[model samples]
Target: MKKKSVGIIAEYNPFHNGHLYQIEESVKATGAEVVIAAMSGNFVQRGVPAIADKWQRAEAAVRSGVDIVIEIPTVFACNSAHNFAEAGVEILENLGADFISFGSESGNIEELKGIARVIEENSEYIENFISKKTKDGWSYPRARRAAVESITGASAASLLDSPNNILAIEYIGKISNALPVTIMRTGPGYNEFETTEKFASATAIRSLINENEDISHFMPEEAKNIFLKSEPVDKDVYFRLICHKVLSADSTDMEKAPAGGEGLANKLKASIRMCSNLEELSESLKSKRYTRTRIDRFICQTLLGIDREKKTDNYIRVLGLSSNGREYIREVKKSETCRLPIITNINKDIKNFKGIGYGISVDILAADIYNIAAGKDLYRFSEYLRRPFCE
Candidate 1:
């Protein structure tokens, strides 16, 4: 029996066949007895509510062969890629994972690691290079890629061309200890969507679902069932709510948000006055200094009341786990595998807490907002009332 555990971090926006492939490959590659997943709660790194809630996604992961599934926290889940990777790394480290695996466009784990090392070693030089590039009208990501090319080579910069490849570098860069594994990405590109393809991108799968197309090929049965039944978040309603929040907030309130600062706040207020939807709002505010994804991050942070100096709650919120996962947790608790308090039920420890100082509280707030978007109030689906799903 393999003694080691492997960790995978993902949004699993709706766990699909690609996710299942990663789960099996991670085990085969690492010979890991347990596969622990650090998942985004209600919101994803792309600054949007998950197609299904966190519980549904976690349960899907467990059914698809992940042993233990934990929340990656709202503060990290809905932020930029760097923050997302850093938070995921920290949680897996806490879980005592011996290996980490991720899907990447480049499919070269060693090359990515080499690039990560070069970036880490020349952090100061990179920062200066990025500043120069950005000043000359480049986006932060573009600037960073060019800066890396200046140090390593063109191939190293090419690694950042795709979304998954960018995430791979971040995952490897943040690794202080765990062994890294890379699975070559197959099928359409991360942004490309083809519902007819066997390995459709999650983006395509989501679009197919949105169009009410049968996605049985892309998703597992359990995930497909959940996706079909779960109340999808009403983006229109949520966008209206955000517009109201932006239109009503004064300069002082916007300044306090600190996500976009005073200038971003002004732009947000101006954008909401004209735009009726999230897409329009983003387009209205998009500029040389900010990419669409950057705008989305700022808007999400602003809407969620996240401040500049984000605080961490330092708690492990277990969404769900399988029988093997439970056994694995028991082992971790017996030893020093995980250093943080493992929270299984929010109703007990997290629900009634009046203070917002708890790190998990942010996740709770995000869930409640999702509840609102999902047309639930005082519903059992609230994260507060959720008990760990054990299979």
Candidate 2:
């Protein structure tokens, strides 16, 4: 009989104990013999550079309990939750995963699926409402809440309040071929910086690392070692890079980037002149309608040249895999349903491709800038030089 497989979509910004627990429990709950993770590359959804590079983060995940780690290209990785979830689920489905697993605050998959169903059924109405609201200076999240409330009442809209629950809905809504399995999230909340007995949110872990505090108990032994050895990318450096990129870019060009419309490009251009760092720039641009995260994402989009109109073919970029992971890859490749092109070796595989799309170019640019932020060697075409991690 063939072994069962489950897929997870995560940043693993730095793999933590909570992530390890989720992976272990996902296996237990689903009876999955293989676990595959679609992880963010150099950038994360929150519009920030990951503490460590993608390869190192993938290494940490593999060292922990994850069987396979594939790269969610930077274009989708650093965008809104909807795009992030869509890209991740598409990758897993194309990779021939039998199930898709994620962490959720409510843990009740039924309620989450219900929300997804409602939204899907009323998608046109909800989107039209949201469009009108956003045009009236309402943030997307608030507009979405109001739209949901209009159709299903406040009770259903309230479900979108939790970050994990919101993501769970997106995953459930986007998933077509794979079964959805959600593990109850424990420890601190998504943005919480507090530590628990043996678990801490990735946010807390990053904060602890920044403060040079002991995070030994927060991560698995092998993962901790990998993190300690790698240099965390400096946020300030990333901010400065964004600022530099905008100096040469005009408002018209900046408007080409994601979320850079409605005079935001001009605002960003002016803000860059006065602000010393990212926070200051975000604050200067933030208003009742525009959020700090939105501003930050726009800034990142500009730096990475993320044009919303640019069409790119999505491919599965495998970063690392354990022994079981390798066998699973071979099995999936042999299956007729697995049609997505898998790139394990960058130099060899990428060269054969006809043309790289804007989405992929953004990923390549992301790596180059990530190395700059992390103060690593800046070899030209460095993406081709680096090889995937295999254990």
Candidate 3:
């Protein structure tokens, strides 16, 4: 019998205790023998560099508990929640996953499904409402929440207030081939910087890392050792690069950015001149209509030269694998359910990505740039030189 495989969409920025809990709980809940994680590479959805690069993070995840870790290409991984969730679901489905799991503030899967259904049913109305509200100087999240409230009532709309709940709704909305599983998120909130007895938010862990504080208690021993040996990518390291991109970019060039258009390019150009640092620059661009995350994403997209139109077909690019993961891949590849080409090796399997080169190119570029940001020389074709981490 084929073992049940469950999929997780994660950005294990440092593979903290919370993530470890999620993996264990997800496996317990689903009875899934093989766990696959589609993790963000180099940069996360929040539009900042990860604490460590993709390989280190993936290795930590595999060593901790996850059976397999695959890279979520930079284009979708660093974009909006919808894009992130949709791409993750697609990749997991392509990998022949029987279930998709995630951490959420509300672990009630039925409630989440209800909310997703309502949102899908009212998408057009919500979009129109969002358009009207944005014109009235409201942020996208606030507008969308209000729109949802108008249709589903305040009780249901309030669910979207939590970050994990928001993602839960997106994951539920996007899943077609796999079942949805939600593990109740414990400890501090998503962006919370507080440390609890057993769990700490990734935000808190990253802050601790940035401050050179001990995070030994917050992460698994293997994950901690991996993180301890590596230098975390400092967000400020890319500030100068961002400034250069913004200053040197023409109106056309700015419009090419993933977050560009609607005069935002001009706003970024103007803000870059007066701001002394990345935080100040982001603050200067912040408004009711544009959240800090949106601004940060724009800055990252600009820094990496990722454009709005550079979409690519989805492909599963494995970053790390455990023994069970290798066996699972071997079995899954022989089955008709595996819909996408799985590239375990970049050097020899680069040909499998012929038509889907755009996403891979973006990932390579992001990694090379991340190397520079991490104070490493740009090893030409680093993507090709690196191999997937195997247990």
Clashing pairs in 3: none
lDDT of each: 0.81, 0.87, 0.88
The 10 consecutive residues of candidate 3 with the worst lDDT sum are 231-240
lDDT of 2 by residue, 1-391 (tens): 3468899999997899899999999999899998899999988898878888899999999988788899988888888999899989999998777899999998999989999999999999999998999999999999998888887789877889999999999999999999999999998998998888999999899889888999999999999999889877777888889878999888788897777788999888878889888888889999978888888888888898888888777788999999999998888877756666788877677776654456667887899988988888879437877777998
Per-residue CA lDDT of model 3 for 203-317, tens digit only, reads 9998888788989999999999999898665566678878777888786776787776668888988878798889999999898889999889988888877887767887889
Model 3 earns a TM-score of 0.97
Model 2 local distance difference test score: 0.87
Which candidate number would show the highest lDDT if scored against the true structure?
3
Structural similarity to truth (TM-score) of each candidate = 0.94, 0.97, 0.97
Q: Could you tell me the lDDT of residue 86 within candidate 2?
A: 95
Off by over 4 Å in 3: none
**Candidates ranked by lDDT:** 3, 2, 1
lDDT accuracy of residue 120 in candidate 3: 94
Which should have the higher TM-score, number 1 or number 3?
3
lDDT of 1 at 306: 70
